[model samples]
Target chain A: MSSLILTHTRYQMLEQMRIPISWVASAFFPAASMLAFVVPFAAADPVAATRATGSMMMIGAISAALIGLSITVSQDREQPWNHYLRTLPAGPLPRFAGRIFTSMAIMAVAVIPVLVIAALFTEAAITWPRLLLGIGALLAGSVPFMLIGLFLGFTLPSKAAIAVSQLLFFPMCILGGLFLPPQIMPDFVQALSPYVPSRGAVELVWSATTGSAADPAGLVMLAVWTVAAGVAAVWAYRRDEGRRFA
Target chain B: MAVLARSAEVTRRYGDVVALDRVSLDIRAGELVGLLGPNGAGKSTLINLFVGLRRPTSGTVELFGGSPRDPLIRRHVGVTPQETGLPEVLRVAEIVDFVSAHFPDRVATPELLDRFGLGDLAKRQVGGLSGGQRRRLAVALAFAGRPKMVFLDEPTTGLDVEARRTLWDGVRSFHEEGGTVLLTSHYLEEIEALAQRVVVVGHGRVLADDTVQAVRDVVGVRRVSLVAGTLPELPGVLGVEHADGRTHLVTTDPDRLVVELVRSGTPFSGLEIRPTTLEEAFLAITSQETTSKETTSEETTSKESTHV
Candidate 1:
């Protein structure tokens, strides 16, 4: 089973590599956003620059987790090849794990440009160990987004997945305090921010990199959302199974 | 001989639709069985049951003495659905390798590719391949696993004559190597050319299950065409239709009819008596079922009316 999972991961990653433009598209936006907004405004202050860089990096990783994973999962369902795989002895586990692992790889690739820009142009200062920890924290925090992606992918048709993933993307960025600090947003929006899973995610990243105090409510909400998304993902999978093969 | 697969009085229903009635079937080892059915005749549904894709609404479907859903049973069975969608991004060889890795034993990638005549296009992406090529690849992957039994649902649906023959060669080779196969096809000729045992399905039930020749015998249709000016009252004359100034008589015994014609001194110069082709035989058999079903339904309606 381990070998099968690894084989699935390798092949899925290779499949994505064939479409080079997708990688560029994923890495492009957050990096472009950093260059546009952060390079000029937040580059001088060490604390502000560091926090902003972390937010953008979270933005890139979460986008890959949510959008990239959702679209691929939805499209895979439409293929006959997926039918064959489900009929195999390996069942769905290996394929599911492989897809999650590949999404992580995509997340890693997406954050590179943001990291490079932060290091070169901004005065964002963090020790090597802290930077590595911040990266790990960002990935761990992206779990809910990955589960959401899986849920969306399994439940929606490919065309609808595309539209819905795009629809859900920006609101997450805004609520997570990626674009602007929650403090500066409307009072109601700020109060609502702590309840959004994204805010919890970026708070973890911020604490790891800039020593920001984490919000307990946001962290608890993120945990709740992760569990909720995981259940939905599994439910969506069974629903798809019943519809197609039952 | 051991049974490789069996369904015991299986019935499958989709909401109000009865896709398969209480159908019982046994497929023995090393036998190539052909499933013949018209559209909506439950060929795919039955295959799905055997492959463990769907559970029977009632009754049992088993493979290799175990439920097909069991991985141990599935490890030895392979299937090609009616239509396969190959992942477009991967090259042919890569996809083959990916599939072959799942089995404990497999046909060598090169041998599998060569058998399907796909050796030259190994590096070409699947999206770039023609529909025929993709189908060939789909069939080739089924054999790649070196399965003990295979289910092929219209494996040659989109191929030209040469491609069909090439694929038939692969099937023949696999069968010769003692692999059991069950296939479904609209092309009766394909079944005639490949299947040793024939099973005909109609209206969600098995109409006939016998040897290929036995099923053909059950059809029992012969065509007797001759240039006879006046038609004679003949024995075993099922129907009479004329074409091109010739009387075409449908019958069970053409030789006897010809002998009768000769004895009666019916002035016939151009005489032709030939056995019905398999296609005609199939139509004759399926249409007979339709007629019988209609009669039964009419009887039921009359019985209900009497009660009213």
Candidate 2:
């Protein structure tokens, strides 16, 4: 299983390096967004700007995870590799773990440029403790969304998966508080927002950046969603087994 | 000990359609067995079952001493599937390397690639290769792991005559090295040339399974043609037709007819004798089976209508 995971990770890294599109979006998007924030409001407080910057960074990571998982998993299904993997002794678990791990690694690399851009553009606090907390919060918040991506990858056809990912990204980001502060929403919307994966991630980011204790209720909800998505992914995978490339 | 290498009494169904129905066979080791059938004869399905790609709905598929899914059994098995599913984005070398990783011991990629005439194309993307090249590469991948038994589905579908001969040489060499091969092909000549035993399948069942010569014998007739100067009415002859100043006789014993023709000293300029081909036997078996099935269905339908 470990060997399979390592092999998958190696392929994923090689594929990412070969494709320029992913790097362009990963490096440029957050930097461009940060520049927009800094240029417009030079007088904004460093702490507030950093909080907003961190939320935007979280949004970028979530989006990347969604897109990456959908495209990669769908392509894998279309290829013979999925069938070949099934014939292997390791079975689907190793392949699934490898893909998830690779996606997480890619998402982490994607978050780096955003952090750098935020540091350069705004008077955002770049203390070691805050940076650690920020990175941890971003990763934790990404879990539910990544799981959601896995669900989408497993259940939907390739074209539908891409379209659904694109369609869901912005609406979820807006409702979940990645685009706007969750507290500013109406009470009914705020109540419903906790169920959305992006909202939970945004709240985690908000708490981490603002030095607030993590939202226990939101964390629990995210965990439930993650677990539920994981179960669905396994079911989908089993159903798809022996069907591809045959 | 029994010479049979594997046996199956397998059935598989997809929703309401029965893909296979109690299909049973015994394939002996070191014998190249041909699975001959038309489309939808469950040829692919049976191969899939042998490779552990699909679980049988009922009954058993035993390979060697155990099921096909047994890792110990699989270690000695290789399959070149009908559909070439080589990864398009991967280079030839990478694809070979990736599949080689699954085997217990590392395969000689460079030698295998060179043998397949893919040495120069190692760095070329799989999608860029021609169809025949892709087929050869797929076959080469199957050969790399040195499996004790190989399953090839229509192995020579996209090869030129020369390439086909080359592949035949490779297959002969593998068998010479004491490997068992189960092959399926639409080309009767290929089966006749390569397989010592042939299993004809139709409507998800084994219509006939025997040696190539044994199958021809089942049809029990040969065609004998001689010049029209004089022809003898010989016993055991099924029928005779005169055409184009020659007599053609369908007979169970062509040797007797030939003896008679020579003794008569009837100014025969040319005499040709040909045994029934596998193609004729296969067509007779499948068509006869289909006709019987149609009659049974009709009888049942008429009886039901009468009762109603």
TM-score of each: 0.85, 0.79
lDDT of 2 at B214: 93
lDDT of 1 by residue, B1-308 (tens): 99999999999876556778999999999999999977666787788788876778899998999997776678898877323467788999998898888888988888889988899999999989998988898888787788999988788988999999988988898899999999988799999999988999887799889988888778788888888789678887767888889988878888788888889987887888777766666777777787776323332322221110
Pairs of residues at least 3 apart in sequence or in different chains that clash in candidate 2: none
RMSD, candidate 1, Å:
6.4
Q: Evaluate all candidate structures by whole-model CA lDDT and list the values in order.
A: 0.83, 0.72
Expressed as tens digits, the lDDT of each residue in B1-308 for candidate 2 is 33434546788776545667899887767878898986667787787777665678898888777766655567677767333566666788977776666677656889989887888999988879989998898788777677878888788898999989999889989988888889988899999999999999877788888999998888677878777665656665666779998887877778887787778776676788888678766765777677665323332322221110
- lDDT for B59 in candidate 2 is 87
Candidate 1 docking classification: acceptable
Candidate 2: which stretches are off by over 4 Å? Answer: A15-17, A22-43, A79-81, A128-140, A163-175, A203-211, A241-246, B1-8, B62-73, B81-84, B221-271, B290-308
* Stretches of candidate 1 exceeding 4 Å from the true structure: A185-195, A242-246, B14-16, B81-84, B160-163, B227-275, B289-308
Question: What DockQ does candidate 1 have relative to the true complex?
Answer: 0.24
